[model samples]
Target: MRCLENRVPPPLLMVIIGLAMAPAITPQLPYAAPWQWLLCALLVLAGGVVVSLALRAFVQHKTTVNPLQPARATSLVSSGIFARSRNPMYLAMVCFLTAWAVLGGWQWQWLGPMLFAAYIQRFQIAPEERAMLQLFGRDYQEYTAAVPRWWRWRTK
Candidate 1:
């Protein structure tokens, strides 16, 4: 969440909440799409949420409520979920975007996921990683060398 620090404007959070609620707002859409697509979206959403939350709880235990700034972290998380993906929460957001697109039967919503990934990579993630690498040194280097940027095909 270092990327989420003070950099996240108040209005942006509100906008994110609203954008994220896009699927829920369109109640008619949940009944849309083929069942297979809906099921796939559900599974993806559930898995992503579970994995990401577990990783955050287990590895990033320290709360960074104000994560936008470059500051020293209370802990250097390198085990559990951190060992897998450096940006699981961001990946989870992508999963949510994909799921919402499918669940809403808005194929155009697929753009949501792609756009989210690009935006996060450019704005939040890349910077946080550079900071992390600088803070954690060779430890972070080794982790990055081993972990996939967006997935864990090599792990499980």
Candidate 2:
């Protein structure tokens, strides 16, 4: 159980789940070519920016970005993309999935992002938060109190 917490990297899990959900995403709606491409491109660019900002913050702080090694983190980043979402890296992945779903015109593919979020929240973010609590104590507590796990635009 706990041993499986950080075993599978989130990106890998998302890919596996997305593939499994592919069949359901078929019979996709026909959408305007330009509009679909525009939406997909926007999502991918947003995701790239979000992920890059998160990675830059981690590098700046000299913290480990490896999800499998939260204990190796040397600092807690609560700025930049992190301020908007406690798990910006995960959010970036969700954004990419959203783009995929949209491009495929598969309403069922929308489930990929939702499922990814749920899985990360349960198995990845939860354990990482616990480790952060242990490592940073009050600072991490304050951060959790302030920043929502997914996005600040959403309710706590």
Candidate 3:
């Protein structure tokens, strides 16, 4: 299991998990209401926007976006979408998976996102955090303190 860390690309892992869970998504709803389709489209669009913002932030900061090379990052990005979620790209992947599950119309399909999150949290994110801390030290710690790894809503 340790050997798997940072090895498999997240998008590939997401597709693999989704396909592995397909058999359990059987007897999907016979019909999708127009609103359900609209919801799915919205979710995918949101995911795209998030990942795009994350990528643009990385490019703007001149940091390495390679998940396999977190230590190579030149800057710690903590503004814009990054200010909200430390791992917006991963969150976007979850959004994409959630949209698929919604369209599938089966409760079990939700496991795709759940499993992906768990795996990423343990395998990808943990190691990435270690690298960030090693590279950026207190600045990385401050950023983590200010932002959740995933999204959170505020009610103030």
Q: Which candidate leads in TM-score?
A: 3
TM-score of each: 0.71, 0.88, 0.91
lDDT by residue (tens digit), candidate 3, 50-145: 999999999999988999878898999998898889999999999988877887777778889999999999999999999999999999998888
Per-model root-mean-square deviation over C-alphas: 4.6, 2.8, 2.1
lDDT of 2: 0.85
RMSD of 3: 2.1
**Candidate 1: global Cα-lDDT?**
0.62
| Model 1 regions more than 4 Å off | 1-6, 9-31, 34-48, 51-66
Q: For model 2, how does the per-residue alpha-carbon lDDT over 23-52 read when each residue is reduced to its tens digit?
A: 655445354378877997999999999999
The TM-score obtained by model 1 is: 0.71
Candidate 2 colliding pairs: none
lDDT of each: 0.62, 0.85, 0.87
For model 1, residues 1-156, the per-residue Cα lDDT tens digits are 544434763225434743865865377474665884767578587657756574566445664523364345544565666566766666666665566566665556566677667766766667767777788789878888888777674564
